[model samples]
Target: MAASLKMSDDKQETEIEEGANTSTNASPRPSCLTPDRQALADSIMESVKASVSKLRRGDPPTIYIVPQIIRRVKEVAYEPRMVSIGPYHNGKERLQGMEENKLLYLHSFLSRNPDHRLVDYLEAIEELKDKARSCYSEKVGPLMGNEFVKMMVLDACFIVEILLRFYPRCRKMKLVKQQREELEQNEEDLGLISAMKKFLFHSNGFEDPILSTIGMVYLLGCDMLLLENQIPFFLLQHIFKMACPVKVPHLLEKMALDFFESRSMPWNEKIEMNDSYYHLLHLFHSHLLLTPTNSKEEPNLSCIPKFKLKPNLSCIPKIKPVLNKLKNLLPCSNKAPLLNTKRRRMIPHATDLQLAGFKFKKNEKSNNILNVKFSHGVLEITPFLIGDNSETLFRNLIAFEQCRLKAKFHVFTTYLVFMDCLVNTSKDVALLHHNGIIDNLPGSDDDVTHLFNRLCIGIFHNFKGSYLSDVKDNVQKHCENKWNKWRASLKRDYFTNPWSFISLMAASILLLLTITQTFFTVFPYYRPRSQFLIIMF
Candidate 1:
């Protein structure tokens, strides 16, 4: 009976152990925790759920702070200097001075149209507040309801006032000599001329702070074009239309173009205005891609005449083909590959391309600065002006292109990369400058070279099927031509100067005379006197 009791006890212990093992293998149960820990976990879950609910569904963020990697290179280039337009740099002590100016602009905007009260503008911005908030990449917290609405109203009014003040000035400055004369003579332009004169005379004094000093105006313009310092275009348009007595379609864009226009870096006036621009910077970026009226016409390669050797060099024609054939037989390791690949193909630098008989020309035929074309041994690039503001303008444009989600073309980025490939050193800059392709107004060739080289740092783009790929490939193929290189070598080495040409000619004449004299001298010795005389006769 004691043995049976011991066996039953062992069986019960095994069953208890098996039940524990089965429980462990099943899904885990919630652990008993302290009240504080449980509260913390519940708070985190609630916060996550709230954040998930607040997430934007289909609306993509347009305005963004410049990426840290890109901004770290030139931090000041991305930051607003004179004024802050959007909430990104709002209320900073350095930029606070401009806030009073914004209010002053608001007062002036209200003064333009007394019929529309301040409440009307406030209500308008209130309606756009949610849409405007969605435009920014980050939630504009700390600025809610009336605060955000008030900020947008002030900023929008400030821009509209500035544009209104700058419109007449822009018209006066952009007119050519003939256009100005026509404006003076034509009855139609009388009202426009009068307005220009009035603004010009009035703006001569310091009545307005922003427009009085040219330097302040320039700095403010730069600040306005920053990627982070932007308000919505619709907001500006709404405020402008309400403030102005006359409702003119696209007058805001015209005034904006005029306000942004710089004599040092003029833009093509034939830009197409689009309603889809997120902000002023985007509008300006689009303007940089000028539409060519005659884009259907292919680049006239024959317009630039080919380099020709003097016809007097009779032996050159006969020997060139042989030299070219020999050169072709040699392998070219440095030549750019023709295959389309993900990697960006960098063409030879300006000096190197020049050495290979490639000529650089300013492409005045097209206003589109990105229209780089290579044909018939000529590489044509549109004239680009580098000024004090060039870096700020280009950097912001690049940052916008890099950051914006729907920006697939990357036109400015590709242009900069293309320029970077061409300009590796100061010598390259000098070459482009000499060719009238680059107008360096700000600094030396080294500075321009450094600007291009640095602008493309930390920027990424797949260059396989980019706009400049064909031009790049064509340039590479041109450089790889053996005949062109040989011709360039001959011209550079033998005919670089008049002295070298004279020496080559003298040597050639001496060699011919020597061979003739030797042939005549040997004929008298090898043949009989009568036979030699008969041959001479």
Candidate 2:
């Protein structure tokens, strides 16, 4: 009996083991958990609770370099080579070379502000640590706590010192002749500044010194403009104030504009610098786009002709409800629907448009690149200067608009997209080149064609809602008008010269005479066919 009981107990234990295994493997929602499983559940619950608590707070700004935006074609364009300004690119091995320069500049900046101690700068930057962190889209994991604060202070100081040295008036105040020479003695230790001095002063050593100098400056400027490589503008402002309390308003912004001002394309309207900027890149974008002080409307009287556009009302009712749902889902969305509109190429290629009796004129009235207008058979385009840094400048601007300028119409993207649509071939580029609409300082027509084509590759926007929508529709309608079509067909098909026109006229006359003869012969107003034949004989 005791042996039988032991066998039964063994069978029961094996059955319970199998049941537990089945429960664990069969479904994720188990009725019971072991000690180890319970511990894991508790840990996961805690983690989720922590994340939820963080989510209750607001998200950081969309200022980081989104991984999806970085394409393989020009991956280096979005990356910093010599220096990393902010925490996003900090501690990167490739960018470590410039850390020494940052430190040197930091030391110099602190020395200039003798009244304020280094601890004061650190304390001030530390106070803004949370605000600065909130400006980046990503969380600061590797660079947490004191490291983050130190990075901000050093980066801010470096920028202030560089700007002070770069601007004419600020440079005069910061470093006199003797002080500059003294600073230059330790040039080797100053990483980026050392290379910059060589690039600025000793470019004659290179094969193409002019091109080399331009390229170096372009690269340096591009490095600073990288999305991942930026510090907060407020930090810079705070540091600048600490350094020079008596400076005029917007001095920091002015210095930045001076540093990255495009030689080919200058700002159309004078912008009153204000503290309402995000960073240097944002400032540059605002300058180029003429972001109004108190308005969302872009003022381009030249582009705006006396033409009107009628919006498509037929589809609004159907799309409105869905769009309303999306708006609820996504607060602060643009008033316009997110569109994947394939914009109609209004004007044909330069040569084709010219052949169709449309004239190409260089529009000098407005400096805005988007200021393209068609009026009275004339297609006027503002001069677009393509130079060494145009690609870098345009790419960065487009990327910034993509990441930060939420819901706002992408004017720059739309303009580039329009240009890309117009220039589909080398012939189109050549026509624009001939008309002086495109000043190709970079290279050949093919190069310019490829550049424009590549620019709008991944760009998407609400083309219908853009400011140029009316202009595009007008140009398309003008191109497709019956009168214009007839004129173009006549000129292209029949009017090669006086000879062709004469030949066509002669052919027409001969055909008319033949038809008349046939008509008279076939239905003769005579006695009969036999009588007619006899009379003819």
Candidate 3:
């Protein structure tokens, strides 16, 4: 239990150190809790304050946002519940992530011990298999085997690893439907192998420690759960939880408030806070937090007072298609951002384009700048974007397998940053047009677009320093040009089309003639001369 406290306390300790170093006469760090419930109230307040501080500046560069794949051993394993299908008329309720993770593990365990004679254990295993299937069915309904089954198998494999390590003995029983032929009759099958042969050697899971090293890959994530059962979740949770808060809780709180005031949470739904969570927020605020990499520098809110421009619905693209899926569940995101200035804007669902053929280049002309060649036949970094430095930064936090997660995350983060830069630019252009600043625009549309891409390339190249604050305005301008061009294209397509009308008329006449010919042919004497000539020939 005290392990959880380490995250908070360590942060608090760091802040104390910072203060002491800054001021020789700085007060000593606060004492630890005395384990009294009375102190719990105060402790909770302090904790929340710390959480709030971490929220302020955005995540720190050192903060680990990387998705983790930690594996261990577990002593207790159970399938608590199964996720059911949603309403028949509508849909079925799907399994929660945690639930799916558990069932997937259960199935793997049962497969390992297929010969287990215990009725209750066998029944439990059977129930898990069903639940696992239901979970997939509810999530995807019916999917072509190639697409969805592949994903389910991967999911199951990951979950099973948790069990394999937890109960090493689970391997003795056989539970999987498709057992390996080579390792069928022996104890050599200790772990999972690459299910897909073509991608086998190159796959991230191929390097999974338990299987490649040991051969049996069935038990991976389960090992971690078993160890977790012994250590307690609160301890680990506490460590990661208070990393930011203890360091800069006050700063984080102010940042959150500032973000909320600025309307940065525009597209995201509002997050509700409970008492403990609020306390965590407070702790976050106490620490001095780094600004988010993409967050814009506030342009003297008081100096440059708020101004409104007329809305431009004509320029609005079918953003729903673009904004449907930005839903990557941030790992261990306990606190919600109070900042969301563009709430009116659409939140985009990231469509993975797997953009390839990137060329990395350095800019010695400026220490904190670099360039990258993009694939959409153009580069796309103005002042606010480039490669996936975010992934690199988070990689240090939650290390993934052989840095494959790092690579994938880099690609994803890079795409997002590029898109974000474009979006901001588009909005800025619309705003300028509405406000009559079009005449005094910053630069030519082409130049602005080119500059935006250059800036993004610089950001990606200059990971050691420089984020969006270095080039946000230029990026905004560039996106405006792109948006205007896109709007013009849409208008042209909708309003001007000679071929469409002609095609429709021709099709209607052809359909009428075909029907008339069919009716005449059935009358026995209405065959066309071409048909008689064809028969003679």
The residue-by-residue lDDT of candidate 3 on 1-537, one tens digit each, is 688786777787677555435443334345742336435544565666555555543432211112223211110121112221111111223334344544544444334333442243333333333323322112233233333333333333333233234332332232222335434544444243222111111223222334444322222212221211111112212222222111212322232233222111111122232223212112122121222223233222233233456855333233222223212211122322212213432221111010111111222222111122232212323222212122221122122212222332233234335434433454433332333222223454343333333323212221112333233332223223333334333333322366644544554565556556654555355566788667657
Off by over 4 Å in 2: 1-59, 67-70, 140-142, 170-215, 291-348, 490-537
Model 1 TM-score, all chains together: 0.71
The top-ranked prediction according to TM-score is 1
User: CA lDDT of each candidate?
Assistant: 0.73, 0.67, 0.30
Candidate with top lDDT is 1
Q: Give per-candidate clash totals.
A: 0, 0, 117
- Candidate 2 C-alpha RMSD relative to the actual structure: 17.6
Compared to the true structure, candidate 3 yields what TM-score?
0.20
Local error of candidate 2 at residue 308 (angstroms): 27
Which is better, 2 or 3, measured by TM-score?
2
In the range 1-537, model 1's lDDT, one tens digit per residue, is 989996986676566555545444444446755556556655665555444444525567789989988999999898888898888888889988988888787776676555789999898888888888888887665257788888888888888888777767445355433345655567656654544444322332227988878899888899999999999899998887776543345868878888887735545668667788889988888787664222222333344446566644343344445445545543334444322122454676787678667788988876667777776777888897888988988889889999983445687788888888889899999999999999987699899988988998897776666666667666655655546566655665556578767766765675566556656766676799999989879
Alpha-carbon deviation at 83 in model 3, angstroms:
7.6
Error of 1 at 128 (Å): 1.9
Model 3 RMSD vs true structure = 27.1
Among residues 3 or more apart in sequence or in different chains, the pairs in candidate 2 whose N, CA or C atoms overlap within 3 Å are: none
Candidate 1 clashes between residue pairs 3 or more apart in a chain or in different chains = none
